[model samples]
Target: MRKITLTLVLILLLVQSLFSHLILQENTAISTTSQFDTGDTAWMLVATALVLLMTPGLGFFYGGMVGKKNVISTMMQSFMAMVIVTVLWVVIAFGLSFGPSLGGIIGNPAGYVFFQNVSVLTSWPLAPTIPFLLFALFQAKFAIITPALVTGAFAERIRFWAYLLFMVLFILFIYTPLAHCTWHPDGLLFQLGVLDFAGGTVVHMSAGWAALAGAIFLGKRRTPNTSPARITYVLLGTGLLWFGWFGFNAGSAMGANGIAVQALGTTTVAAAAASMAWVFLDKIWGHKPSAMGACIGSVVGLVAITPAAGYVSIPHAIFIGIFSSWVSNVMVSKFPKGKIDDALDVFSCHGVGGMTGMLLTGVFASKQVNPAVVDQGLIFGETTLFLHQLVALIGASVFAFTASWILFFVVNKITPLRVSQEKEELGLDLTQHGEFL
Candidate 1:
């Protein structure tokens, strides 16, 4: 009996040792899987900062175009988005945009509520070399700027409190669904293989359509159109926007790889080409080549190339720049001002430019540029990718415009969307915020 008991004790010790070894090995495997590349993490950090700068750049951009009385109000609208969206993202917006797919229509809000699984130890599936937390932060910058873009359409006439409510509703309903559909792996558009290198579709198109809805819903401003508040501010904003776009386009590559370099190159060339093209077009049309034209044109080019930045060659990017500039310039020059009051022509520059870029992406995308291109663009004699892109464009446009209009209507019911005629004539700065230039 003593010998049997001693044998049983030896067997139990052996089992415990094996179990401990297995646990250590499992922990090691998990650590290896979560290990992040220092280079990628560092680059993403810089890129997030770069993208954040674009909002202030955008604030200046929109602010300069409005009347002097509304300059602060216009800028405050853009600045406000940063604060509001940042808080919302930390709480639940990130989860709604990027959580586990809920049947591919939208992300499951419960998946990452309050950032449950988003941690330093976790890695996003697509951006495997970076911490999942970093990816979420980078995406938050994108969310911040989107609602800000819509402010340009209704600048100088919108009720401040009502506009704030609309921004929140738009993000919760309109923006999240579009983001989930376009970026998430299980998203309908992503699964359909529609490639938006950055945010040509997700950011520009949505903002553009929403701008149109706002312009139509609010009607024209009571005050007559006037010269920009400050051309110098517009120039400064353009410089900032051009500088920050490098991150906006290159960072979408999600790594410090050759693709990022290629995106940077295309972005630079596109903006330069577009700026010159706009000036030249103005000269051809018997109009003086104005500083404002150059600024607007460069922005349009940036908007057009966003979807194609990492997919097309530099030469193709130049064409996209010039073509999109021409299209937007014409739209701006000939816009039916009597029917619609798109202050600063947000729809012309962003909506039209984004559409032009999306179509051109279908025409110019090449597998040689990016391996992710399973179906080459139309130039490569393939129709499948282009067809899919067209379908996605139409689907995204209809959804954004209709949903945004409804949100506007809902917000209007809760609180008036447009300010009273007296407030409008008094200017948003003095009436809304009790300050003026």
Candidate 2:
């Protein structure tokens, strides 16, 4: 009886030891994952806040361009986007974007109804410190701005109820899929090596193209365009956007590393150069440079450098900022003649500027800036990066323009996309919201 009891005790001890070892191994592996870092979390938090600021900045940017009678209505468009988009993101849109891949076209349904299994510590491919939830909020800000950007094209027009309905469907079907294809780790476009860095193509190009489509569908705002409500608002919004963009660009690095710093510096330089370039272009065109031009010019520079922020040098950024601004300015000037009245010129600024940035990124990206492509350069030494950039630009533009055109037409048919002519002339503030601006 004593011998049997001793044998049982020994067996129990062996089992306990094995279980302990397995637990230790599992813990060790988890600890070593690239996602475990405080610095990354902190950076992402800041990035999220920065991106959130852009919505208000965008509100002011668009607000200042429209007549005072519609300023509140215009600003409300962006505000509503923030609220509506966040809800959509958490419930369905987020899953469709970052969930498990479905044939590399979109994410699976696993992450739908977020908060079921996800937490703040969930690791994403780029930002590991934050939970998938945080990433969702960060990306949500991008999604919000995209539809808001379209508001600029249809400013002072479009029924608020109709716009709200359009935005809901647009986020689910349009923005979510594009985001997945461009940023998801297993995304088809990502696999193809399309380097957007910070949404030069995904965010800006998509919004730009969609804006064009919306403008086409909605027709033009009321005639006799009035001066902006407050230039001060525009400047304030510009400053905020500039400040927030650091988070937008640098935060994309997903780490507090040298790359993030480089991206920040390049972003600043490009904006400055682009501002100067716009001023110079205005002078050459025999027009006195306005404060609005300076602000818009800086924004153009920022848009142009977004794709190249982490992939190119400061010198290349300067050239990109200058050249893109020139192109956008010309486009904005001539766009009206084509019978498309882009109210705030969202297509000219974000669309044309983003395209220029993507193309320039191909021409300017060097192996030195990004070691991932060490054998590639664009400064008369390597040409493959340029070709890669060109492919990205063509692919993004074709997809954005084509998809947007179809979506707009379909939505327009289902429900009237534009407001009645009388409502538009009466101003959205009163006609849509029953409020005085």
Which candidate's TM-score is highest? Answer: 1
**Candidate 2, residues 1-437: lDDT per residue as tens digits?**
24643674576457446555554444344433335667867788898899889989989888888887788899999999999888667656788888889987889844344333345545676666566666677777888888887888878877776677778777877777888888898987777777788898788988898888888877766673778888888898899899989988988787778788989999999999888988889999999988899999999999998888998888888889899999999997778734787888899999999989987877777767887644354665777667776777777677777777777777677667777878777787888788875
Q: After superposition, which runs of candidate 1 have C-alpha atoms over 4 Å from their true positions?
A: 1-32
After superposition on all C-alphas, the RMSD of every candidate to the true structure, in Å, is: 12.0, 11.9
Tell me the lDDT of model 1 at 229.
Answer: 94
TM-score of candidate 2 relative to the true fold: 0.88
Tens digits of lDDT, candidate 1, 1-437: 24643674576457446554554444345444577889989999999999999999999998999999999999999999999888778666888889889988788765455555667787888999999989999999999999999999988899988888888788899888889989999998999999999998899999999999999999988765877999989999989888888889999999999899999999999998999999999999999999999999999999999999999999999999999999999999899987899998999999999999999999999989999988888999999989988998899899989999999999899788988988888888999999988
The lowest-lDDT stretch of 10 consecutive residues in candidate 1 is 23-32
Question: Per-residue lDDT for 333 in model 2?
Answer: 76
lDDT of 2: 0.80
Residue 381 lDDT in candidate 2: 73
